[model samples]
Target: MELKGIHHVSAITANAAGNFEFYTKTLGMRLIKKTVNQDDVSVYHLFYGDDIGTPGTELTFFELPRAARTHEGNNSISEISLRTASDAALEYWKKRFQEENVEHGEIEIRYNRKALPFRDFEGQRLVLISEENENGESGTPWKKSPVPAEFSILGLGPVYLTVPDLEPTHKVLTDLLGFRREGSYLSKNYGQSEIVVYASGKGGPGTEIHLEERKDLQRERLGRGGVHHVAFRTADQAELQEWIKKIENTNFINSGLVDRYYFKSLYFREPNGILFELATDGPGFTADEDLSQLGESLALPPFLEQRRSEIEGKLKPLETKVKEQ
Candidate 1:
């Protein structure tokens, strides 16, 4: 079963409004959707990405305002990467961060890729990598943000995962899924060798998956400030079902077809203890809301319509506004 690429990456954040400001104003991604978490209506499930909020372009967050800070450890996702047009775009980002007084680390090279690492308002580590090998769907420009037409984000870059042992995780990524070993490196921070995996073709945004081996580091707890799950894309429902069978046959428990409103999802955890999802690509976020008013209001799945008023009252109000640097 061949996988197309990443569908979306979800994480937990501390403040919804702060995250909104950072992602939309600081990072220049469009606030594509503002909704509530299906399971927990008290929290906001905010999504930020390219215009039109394409499937693979989404970076979602669950806001838990009072949650405690989580320590970054071996069993957690280390960083989220976004791909830009070139190294020159990264330079532009550096200048933008400086102008905003947001402290960013120096640009670094890993696994032969150039990346600039920075943090959001909630301390979620994010990287901007300049790689143009993979083709991206063209979308409308986010006119409100500082991002210009040419250098806007292509989409999500490699989702970084860490584990205690590298072999089992590597096997799941290469054998079960179709990612190939791109390169390996010794981390200056963790001081252990990390292997980076990329899709079969020359990888770009949402293609590379980084795995770090840290035997001594403790396992991480999933809560605020942690990645929820990493989803890989499939061409359609048939392909998704095929991979579902493939994953179930491998002795992993996979959730059967789940209607995510826009896309269908099948979820399973890999051998390395990382949660992975296989998602379909059609029936997107615009299925209900018109493209013009997509992220401006609370959008819910059809089944939840009867409870809309209660859900809306439970969630905190989040207003989207452009902030000056």
Candidate 2:
């Protein structure tokens, strides 16, 4: 019962409309699903991914209109990495960011790969990594993306987590979650501490997590621009059930076998307090909408269909129209 790569990383955004614009128009990813957070029907939970909203490619956000800016520190999902075609793609993004007035760092190598770190308008940390020699699952870019298909953002790469200490989190990853220790890399910023790497099934950038140990920082105060949780992919309900039993065996408090409609999930926090989710890959975004019409309108799951009127009345209308190329 090995877990696949990342399923999705859910983050917080204060402006649903602005977040929608940045992710779809700026990043050129397809808005695969337009829905509200299941736990809180009043706010939007938007999902962006490749053409068909493939499991590992999804990057989601939960909108909280009045959320405070994130106070960054340790014990957080520090940075998110998006994969692109090659080092030339990094060049394209660097030039694009400059032209768009997007804040970004110069392209540099990190962990033997070219990367360009940048922040969204909300100050959400993100990096684009060149997938020149990377392995694991390849991403399917949206053909109609504003950026050319060859240079478009493909999928999630290695997720970075910063914690005060590493031992506890390391144990949870290597022992409890079945991730293999893939060695460590020296951090250019954090003093003396080496960033450790862990890989799940098919071990590659797509399935890896880069963990940074930082004793110099405080616990993160999460709000807008902060990552809510990162989910790993499981094959189906049966494997998810196995993971549920496995997690239940441990002392970690977990939400067992949650039917997310699009996917089944189990949520828990690692030792460092970073939320982790194990999600199934089946019954995907296509369950409710046609491929061509995804994200064109708000979608609700069966149970929530009855409350659609109440939910729609609360959320501010978000324009999901895409400009024709």
Candidate 3:
């Protein structure tokens, strides 16, 4: 079965306060969930997205205070491209970045679309792609966002990956994941590397995954200021089960059927060592809190509910609300 699109792209950010300011005030995404990492209760897990934190619109960050820096290399998610409506929207973001003093690159073309690439304070590369024609994926905008409704970001677009060897991971994307190869383009920023673009679902930013082969570079280190994993969307549990068997026959391995409170998940590492997850989108953020109060307080899964006081004591409080500019 064909997957719908991206579930979420999770990453690590060293500076929690800086990330809060940048993602909320500057970028204008809603802080949909404020919780601690399930595996590590001491660390904060912050989720940012469109008004309601839709699956494709999500980008999550695990805060690691004083953690070692990671070296960017192969088998890493180098860039997270988000979707905006039009050329004017992309242009509006360029001016907004400059006004906010966020460092950004010049506008560039990729696969006949205009893109504005920029990096967060912690050096996570990001791009805002123009998806004016793909209106179906355009999400509801935050009314209070510094960015206007028409110009706000839609959702996750191209999750650019750097792989040491393309063949191994390419199979996982195509044969197992059901993404068809779209075409290729040479990206000047990544050592003039030829980027292969694969797509699934209907044509839009969220459906595209871009790969840049970098066999010469070393395996990337997992640390602060780097992508943690890429989660692809599965329509339901039945689809997730079918994928487990498909992955079992291949050289790759997966952690099967993890009940992750909001949604079920299956974690697998592609041949190149990048973590990829197939997640079912259901019982979403609204499961715990009303939509209006999302991210307003620390939300724990049923298992962690009793340890709320202890967990709260260990982690620093995240400033979820932003005063509109």
How far off is model 3, as Cα RMSD?
A: 1.5
- Give the lDDT of residue 46 in candidate 3: 88
Error of 2 at 266 (Å): 0.3
lDDT of the candidates, in the order given: 0.78, 0.92, 0.85
Winner by lDDT between candidate 2 and candidate 1 = 2
Q: TM-score for candidate 1, please give it.
A: 0.92
What value does the lDDT take at residue 211 in candidate 1?
81
Ranking by TM-score: 2, 3, 1
Give candidate 1 misplaced runs (Cα > 4 Å): 132-140, 200-202, 321-325
Candidate 2 residues lying further than 4 Å off, grouped into runs, are none
Clashes of 2: 0
Better of 1 and 2 by TM-score: 2
Error of 1 at 279 (Å): 0.8
Q: How does candidate 3 fare on TM-score? A: 0.96
Which run of 10 residues does model 1 get worst, by summed lDDT? Answer: 132-141
In candidate 3, what are the lDDT values of residues 40-68, reduced to their tens digit?
Answer: 99988888889987888889999889778
Q: Rank the candidates by lDDT, best first.
A: 2, 3, 1
